[model samples]
Target: MAVVIRTANWHSERSAIRSIRDAVFVREQKVPADLEWDTLEESARHFLVFKDGEAIGTGRLTADGKIGRLALIKSARGLGYGAKLLETICEHAQTLGHQRVYLHAQQQAQGFYSRAGFIVKGDIFSEANIPHIRMVRDLDFSSG
Candidate 1:
């Protein structure tokens, strides 16, 4: 199935976006509900991935080029949906004149982000009881 991703607003897409994040981050990963959702949401750029009219993945980009709250349903993963989501966010960052993008990748997902051209930078750190590493990817501006 083909998955389409597009920019979304917090007001209109909040339910679908929060559903995916709540599933993946809060329930599945055991992250505290409070830490999973925050005030920065109102100003961030959100994106959602849909397949067959069902929301399957979601992510967000901040003004300073920080990508966060990325999640995909178990069934939607390993099918290029994550990579597509990352690419879409990176493209959006470039459009906003951002030259680099960064995200705090869970240790288990470091390899996945690496495959998407993100490089691990800092030491492993614990966030919300989960091990994570900082990863950065520079956007190619030659074509811009």
Candidate 2:
């Protein structure tokens, strides 16, 4: 699988980004449309993962160092693509001079993020009607 990660422009790539998010969050997870689409898109740096030239996953890093809206189509999960996408986001955050990055991870996905160096920071809460927890990972700028 030739998987490639690319930085996407929100204006030109909104449809591609929305397709993955829609399939994973809206349709599969049943998250409400209103809550899934937020005002943050305009300012967030988006990423799209393509496997063999086909868009399969997406993620974002916000201006304030929050990573969110991570999603992958059902066909793309459990293959390490998510981790690669996340690392790409974190790398971008570091390049932007952020000392650390945080995210509100769905409860079930905590273990995934934990394995990638994020630690649970606080109590559980609800977002988009689903249980989530705050997770944070400090950026290491010691290396290239």
lDDT of each: 0.93, 0.94
lDDT of 2 by residue, 1-144 (tens): 698998999999999999999989999899999989999899899999999999999999998999999998888899999999999999899998999999999999999999999999999999888999999999995874
lDDT of 1 by residue, 1-144 (tens): 667899998998899999999999999999999999898899999999999899999999999899999899998888888899999999999999999999999999998999989999989999999999999999995865
Please list the residue runs of candidate 1 whose C-alpha ends up more than 4 Å from where it truly belongs after superposition: 141-144
lDDT of 1 at 96: 97
Worst 10 residues of 2 by lDDT: 135-144
Clashing pairs in 2: none
TM-score list, all predictions: 0.96, 0.97
Poorly placed runs, candidate 2 (over 4 Å)? 141-144
Give me the overall lDDT of model 2. Answer: 0.94
